[model samples]
Target: MASSTSYPSYKQLKEDFVSNLSGGTVSEIALVCAVAPVVSLLWSTLQARQSFFKPYTTLGFVVDFLLNVGALLLSVTLYSAVPILLNLLLLTAALFIYALPPNLSRKKPRLLPDAKSRAAASAGSLGVLSTKPFLTNYRGNMMVVTCICILAVDFRLFPRRFAKVETWGTSLMDMGVGSFVFSAGVVAARPVLKERADNKYIPLGQRLVKSLRHSLPLLVLGLVRFLSVKGLDYAEHVTEYGVHWNFFFTLGFLPPFVALFQSALRVIPSYAGLAVLLGVVYQIVLESTSLKSYILVGPRTDLISMNREGIFSFFGYLAIFLAGQDTGMIVLPRTLKARKSGSQWTMLLTLAAWSLGWMVLYHLSTTYKYGAGLTVSRRLANLPYILWVVASNTALVSGFGFVDAIFFPAFYNAHDSKTEKEAYEASTSRILRSYNRNGLVIFLLANLLTGLVNMTVPTLDVSPVATMGILVAYMAVVTATAVGLDMYNISIKL
Candidate 1:
């Protein structure tokens, strides 16, 4: 299928944004939000018959529509101290590095035969006992640091509810985007996976064909979502209280999109150019008309939500994910290997910037508007808001790079090989091998845990100290549980 829809040029996109006397027209609208891509994936998955049931699978989804309403009601009954909840998160982040072990490296007692204790002795060099355990420990440390950012910084750092302004609780949304960032990081490290791709090699053409051949779910799902949503206008059932089972729709197209990007960028020297073009076009949609007001900022003053094409948060994430893939291609070379490190605390502190920044941003501004005063569009996020995420991304680099340093010890030495075998690792060859194992499952668990905790917690009623204590306790409990399960070898496949 041709993806050539004549998407806008970077210049055209900029011109469109500037042409707006008052943010332009909504007629050129495209994507919507996170759910939009999810819907697309869900549709594709169903059509592919990859899933057995009729896709009503998210837990507490059906059972909790009523519960959502109950929580909505709780808002009225409870005397909320929502700000305190946020402060607690910030406080936990401030203290996180201290609670963690001080040493920066992952070392273990060598269970070896003859000269096995030396870290320098590669399995081949010293005749066998692999260094994977020490490497896994190192990756695990980085993983914990990143998870700290996930649980304490992004996960817990934001107000739960805002009364008058759509952007008042912007930090919470920032945390949500963190999930996407972390997920993308895991995807980029596909070389670290335990799976041996050489043995399972399927040509790119065949892979694409297989992917398309399995896209029946996408067709059915998109059609069903389009029909149920557009034709019947059942959005009342879909707004926070409802579930559309849409991830199936988006997943169908996203992988193909990623693989396609990998192939296209291999030849094209302008993937960044492509991203800039897409980003500018999307920026036009953000600044123009009431488009943002409806799809991203909410209340849907018009029927414009029906126009889910190339103009919303969905487009933003796809563009960003593509950008991420391009980045991964540049960074993840074939010959990666693990290293030992002793700087865990430093990495954790650097990542802590995200939390501190969010705390400061939230304390200073209550909204997500991008420009100066009176801006109501959350979609038109302010310079600081955008900058905040940039800073967060910067913080993440310290964490991810720290991990890469250890697990990808041979990172600097890698070169693309014909078989990609020297470049890649597994049992026959695998790299660091301790990247995110069950990403989606972890995402679900994090989101679910956030929901369950928020559901039971008191509103502004809790003191700042008390709230901070609770947030830390909750995050620790949730993270440790996930880590424990991972340690025990029970999780969704990587």
Candidate 2:
């Protein structure tokens, strides 16, 4: 286990902050908070309202350009205080927009759903609210935004010191991307899973064929990116897993494992059950043998360490995905009852309690076993990390759900209670929608561009300010191009 590091003193923190600001760290943070959030939130709102793909008006683009320019200036100039304030401002704006009532001028007044009807139907028992699997766009949008943010920092566009391995509340890039893939798999499988019966018969050969067919595209992208980066001979860093293992390798492998297990199991196990079983088995095997040493340092271990984290950890990733599937099963029910505010509050509180409990359990278990605080190892992706990821994700979902519940009436203001249902098939967030439509293209584009930037520009030799500017510009171009392509209904999928 990694030893704990001390928190920095106020004087040290101030010095670090000043140094970072002078070196242009604020610009990256500013871009993440200001530009990324705006894109994410605006696109999500437009998606919810089915107003995306409306031609980009000259006035709208002009306003957006000005806003981004102003945000950049504030970041570069103020450096310290402004970024924090701007983040708060962005959070406020997001909440305001979320809580904003429907356009009453253009639409008729819509009332909140009658909680009394639901409550009476329950006959004094706690009413069951069958919610959609995940809160749809919010989780996916957040994942993309986070991936962008993590990449921004990881590529040295942000201060390199911020990537320090020991920082408190650090979200490692590997882990972030891994979690995103796990969530994506879970969400993607929902359509098939919704109707999958426990007794359904499926030949193993058919499952393998299906898995391979689905995995082939991902495999091609993985090989392309791997060869391209190595072929170009870009600067390579240790990155924990060394140079060969990447997320693509993990992506390429997970589908087959998922297919094999799903085809073999009678019914999918519960999230909690799978997590415990996988984690315990992994830890036991790891503890009982020298597999760790073999994978990490023994001769010619490259084949087994496909994710650069060792082979066992892939099992943990699969478990995480399965947990996500369980989450879908719990939330995505056809017989959804409109929930009252009180019931919604109770649900939110329940989720918070679960997160808190898991957090405490994670810390206690790790401390008892290892005599150290739980370290989230992307390399191993052990028990504590799984618990942490699940808890954090649930907390995020519940918090978003709570907010929507608080403003339920506003969300329903466009139609009557009967008509105001979750729009399962309606998402028009150009940024996220485009990314979703062409996941491989976007990922490959980012990698290809990163390689190009490294080769063409003296990235490591540049000032922090220049680096931030380059990264923001690069990301803006990628995302904007995606949005534009999506506007034309173009998806470059395999």
Q: Which residue pairs clash within candidate 2?
A: 133-332
Name model 1 segments beyond 4 Å from true: 1-172, 175-179, 189-253, 285-311, 334-391, 399-435, 453-473
Query: How many residue-pair clashes does candidate 1 contain?
Result: 56
User: Whose lDDT is greatest here?
Assistant: 2
lDDT of candidate model 1 versus the reference: 0.36
Stretches > 4 Å off in candidate 2: 1-87, 92-103, 108-136, 146-151, 154-157, 161-170, 197-201, 263-268, 305-310, 337-354, 368-374, 408-429, 492-494
Write candidate 2's Cα lDDT for 14-101 as tens digits. 2233222112232343243343344334434543433333444555444443333334333333343345666566566656665766
After TM-score superposition, what is the CA distance of residue 99 in candidate 2 from its true location, in Å? 11
lDDT of each: 0.36, 0.52
Residue range 49-113, candidate 1, lDDT tens digits: 22212232343222222121222112111312332333343335324533444442322244455
TM-scores of all candidate predictions against the true structure: 0.45, 0.70
